[model samples]
Target: MSRAKSPFSPAAVLRGALVPMLVVALWQGLSMSGLINPVVLPSPVAVVERWWAYLLPPDPYDPAQGSWFLWALSGEMLFDAWSSLYRVVLGFAVGAGLALPLGLAMGGKPRIYALMDPLLQILRPIPPIAYIPLAILWFGLGNAPAVFLIAIGAFFPVLMNTIAGVRHVDGIYLRAARNLGVGRTTMFIRVILPAATPYILAGARIGIGTAFIVVIVSEMIAVNSGLGFRILEAREFMWSDKIIAGMFTIGLLGLAIDIGMNRLNNHLLRWHRGLEN
Candidate 1:
């Protein structure tokens, strides 16, 4: 007799893939049936064709020397995508690095919380977009300002979560550690940090997602060489296909980053297994 396949089999993968295929098929079918305007909602095939033309530009079809064509370097959407990605990573890292330590300090001591809570309340309410004018005045336009915005965007979620996590660490665990004559440093490193790992991962996940939004907005305002800028440029030229492509690229990148972070989260919090399941 044939053995039954495992739950994690390739068959499960095929089942997951079917939903998107069906959705794409429906979209393409609607366009082909004239239910959707080719101008307003171009078929997937048209988008793919335009994407092809945009990427692999060819010799002039018309003899005009200065005919409008995609820019050889800046026009490649992938370059812009990479540029935005680099800034997001840098900014998100800065936010997390600073937030975690500050959060720990506040959570570990009442005095620190009294000093920092009011500032967090005032700043957290201010949306990243609202700060664009000030950020521009402070840092000027370019990657520096864009990264600053992303850092600002990512900082709060991590900071707030980390503080809560550290504070809520099991009191019993701390008592147990103290009974064992653990030093303050050993108590924090050995008892508190591990207990707060789940919350830290949760905060990191949220921060990464928030960073994606901030990075895009920052790029639109401050940077001239990222996916957001490409989207703006495509709109100016009325290249809807490229515009959609850039938006899709940003979304795909965000989803991929989130998935990777979740995997990391799961690995770090394995002891808390089935909590999220």
Candidate 2:
């Protein structure tokens, strides 16, 4: 069951902020106190300042010599984030689309499941990063390889979860449908699909996370643009602040995405009692 709702509670927000604010305060104290080298571990504020440079337009009076550079830097952050997001959506959609039907068929029929299980077993264990070299060679860098890598990474979670969800449907449902003379297509549309929705959504959520992980890896090596590439570029310059900023930016985006997915899942599975937390 869910927890009881509280009236507009600043206390709840403060509770959530307690640890993070403490950590930030400690980090700032250590950096400013010179107890920790900023080069080794930049303070959160320093990292945020670096991100601001990459995200904000230049001050108009700062000098034309500097304004162009600031604008370009800001554009770089926007472009990289957009590129990565684009790849994640494309790859996740493609992979999930391909997974659903195959998984449904596999879960519904023993023979079909047997035939597909071997291939799934063989490929499922391999990390998407393992395919990078071949992906680069085959797709030859840029978004193609990154997209392919993301797709491969996102695929299995969805497939496996879909199959599991389908399998989880009560046998009584199937027997009842058959006794009612429901045809195969009608039964699948009215019964199987609804029963498997939760599993499919769970798999999609996992797939989204996987897509993000694989996209970063793919971007680091296969492509020249994205937050992953920005981090690598910062490393080349020995810009610890920028590197950490890029990392935090990626983490923040991933967290936002995960929250969005969790909300969507709860909405879709509102009737599913086991999902309540």
Candidate 3:
């Protein structure tokens, strides 16, 4: 008869914040003690100040700036955030869209799986970073190359998990559906898909994170208008504060995306939870 604690409860929030706060305190103490070089590792307070400025900088409006793309790259935090988010979303969509169907086919049919698995295994071991050079060469220096890298990073996890999910659908459910006179298509749509949804969602969470990592790395080389690009630009100028701030921004964005995905999973998997309970 014990009650479940809400994740958003004050105690839960405090518990989550505790470790980060402690780390920040230790960082500040080290900075004050002159144990860490400010140029190399700016204090938490300095990072925060820089982040505040980056979040709310003076308008760099100039009619001569001409293109909207150039205006966005003019040290605007929101634009950088939006740019990164856009790439992640587009890339993830492309990756998951292709992966889900192919995975379904591969999982459901041994012949297809046998045909495709070897090539995939070979490709999967190679890191997505390895594709960056070719992606840039093919797509040139815009969102396309970054999106391509992110998609590659996202694709394998989702494909593998989806295949596993479909393959591992409960035998009981399959037998029940067959006994109930369900057609192949009907059985797959109604029984297999519902049962496999949880695993597919798990893959999606992992895939989204992979997309974020790839997009950032790709932006550092492929593009010039994301948080990743900003971080690199800051490094070139030796603006350690801005670098730290950009890093924090990326972390926060990733965290927000993770939380959103978790919420989606919870909402979608309510039936699975009930079955387990």
Candidate 4:
């Protein structure tokens, strides 16, 4: 039997690293060649150095120097990261919590679909960023507005995916369940939900990416602390290295979240994979 390839294998690791390594090399070359102004776009090395300094603990030897580092740190990188993470989690939870049930109901019942679909269709096309002013007005300048924006970003993707998943459940499964005299609740719980899980998960993955994007945008305006806020603050000061560091931090965090979501998807869809195999 052929063994499953491990992502951690050296070959896989090398393949993954090649493009990123090449890009960095090109970036460094451009920086060194003085084609681009350092003030406009800092070198990757400078960004890395800034990130390292941002992560370091304050020096105890000279409190004044430590204060300078602390000021530059802007409440520490980890704290800002955690703040962004918390908003994403909370907002995503609220969005998914509402969307899942509503989607299921709409998908299962034509009446529900007819009643809601028109309004949802109209609203879905509106960008989450468009809601920023209203969100701030409604929730004021704090976590509330950021969370609201993130929820708005997450809601539509999840809702659409869930509805599609449920609607697309194979007709054969419904026939089989009905043939067995299964009640509506049992049929839905045992057959429809399982069949739709993969689609729901797919939607969730998309929603999470949207959540991250919305959270960052919201943080830039709605809240005073987060990676987005840091990036914006750096921009105001013309600190290109710090801005790049913050951008990289957000990228790394998004990568971590995507990896986690993939693991969850694998765990949940093992049965589906077995059937396909």
Candidate 5:
């Protein structure tokens, strides 16, 4: 018998942190020794200082300069993050809400699947970035274009995954439901949906990642306020530390979202012990 893996074990946690800790130490040493130009590759300390400045008031004695606008940086960070979050959630909800039912119908009905599969196949290959110009022209920039781009990015993943899930459900389950005199609506609600939960959540996880990616790209070109826009703006000012800080912010937020989603998926799918592992 094979032993199960526990990824959250103490050994695993230490092993994961070791590399990053070493890297941070190496980075600090290099900057202090002047082996690397701070402008070119800002130290880990510098990046944290810049990030801290963004989240809190800057002291006059701080080397970065300026007394700061009370809560300007934090406000911008929160506002931009909120703006991106709103667009992604709204678009994702819209896309998945529509895709789930359609996907279920398609999987349950071969006639519908045959009719729709070809079209989906053709459209699915088209990248979301390709639609940016048209989105701008049609939606005219700002939140509308951003949301549209995110929706396009997220739609197909959920649709395909949901269809796969429903279609792959065990035949015995369907027969058992019918044999039990379960009504069509009750069958779908109690049996089909629950059976397909794994696949749907898988799709949702993929869709949210795509949504975040598209929202970032959309913000860079179509909107003025977001982590993406902030990164580009920092580049224009040649603020390397600030730019790196912004990148870290985006990465941390993405990681947090992914972790939260994973936890939720695990909680809901506790019966599927393999997934939790």
Candidate 6:
């Protein structure tokens, strides 16, 4: 039998688009009415025009800054984006890599839990921003500091979720695995990890978001160049539209990364679909 169409089908695209369209319409209306200052809140059309200008060359006054339209396509932009992205990936990886094993050990053994649980509890509540000063002092103002901040930001979700997942594993499954002559290591890999995959994926998703937050904040403070720096520069020069454009770009990229991660999680956890259904 075929399933019914989901409410969130392609038509939902139009439905979703409506809110932003209304917002833009209202904004344009306000601009025309002169109720809003164009300096602070440019019209939707103006923002679009500026965005287009940034994405394509206008009449060149000087050939250098004239290429502002090509900024998004430039090697510098790509490199900066990549540098920020790399920090996130590396930090998330480090956090997850360390957290998984540590969480497993803590959850799987009471002795380890007794020793480590208190520490994790204490540390987990500290905001990633709190670590920035120390991170800067320890790693200096470069990728190291940025990645360190990202790692700190990403660590807690993975650690906490993994511990929760491992703690809640079905005892019957553990018994069955042991009854089948599975070693502890084999049971963990074949049973616990698979069972914990959902929570792990959830943690990773949160971690990725945290990574982006850390990247932007870290870039703002401790880096010379990145989207954050570009935005700051635009603000300093009072290029309000460019600043707005940069913010939009950051939002779009962050959203794309999140959506991509969600898709990957769905693909990897297909088995969980049966249980949910």
- The list of candidate 2 runs beyond 4 A from truth reads 2-8, 58-74
The local distance difference test score of model 6 is 0.81
lDDT of 1 by residue, 1-277 (tens): 3454655689977887899889889989999999867767777877777766655535444435454543344346657777888988999999998999999999999999999999889999888778889989999988888888888888888998899899999899989999999999998888898998888778888888888888888877887888888888878877777777777777778888978887888778878856553
Return the number of clashes found in candidate 4: 0
Which lDDT value does model 6 have at 190? 94
lDDT of 6 by residue, 227-252 (tens): 77767777787777777877887887
lDDT digits (tens) for residues 87-194 of candidate 4 = 999999999999999999999999999999999999999999999999988999999999988998899999999999999999999999999999999998999999
Q: Give every collision pair in model 6.
A: 54-69
Give the Å shift of residue 179 in candidate 4.
Answer: 3.1
Question: Distance (Å) between predicted and true CA of 16, model 3?
Answer: 4.8
lDDT of 5 by residue, 1-277 (tens): 3553666899888888999999999888989998887788898988998987765534343436544444354456666677778888998988888899999999888999999999999999999999999999999978898888888888989999999999888989999999999998998889998899999999999999999999889989988988888888888988899899988888887998899899999998998757724
RMSD in Å for all candidates: 5.9, 3.8, 4.0, 4.3, 4.8, 4.2
Off by over 4 Å in 3: 1-18, 60-75, 274-277
What's the TM-score of each model vs. the native?
0.84, 0.89, 0.87, 0.88, 0.87, 0.86
Taking the tens digit of each residue's C-alpha lDDT, what string does model 3 give over 115-201?
999999999998999998899889999999898899998999999999999999989998998999999999878988788898899
Cα lDDT, model 5, residue 215: 86
| Whole-model lDDT per candidate | 0.82, 0.87, 0.90, 0.91, 0.86, 0.81
TM-score preference between candidates 1 and 3, better one: 3
By summed lDDT, which 10 consecutive residues of candidate 4 come out lowest? Answer: 57-66
Q: Mind sharing the TM-score for model 4?
A: 0.88
Model 5, residue 192: what's the lDDT? 91
Error of 1 at 106 (Å): 0.8
Clashes of 1: 0
Q: How many backbone clashes does every candidate have?
A: 0, 0, 0, 0, 0, 1
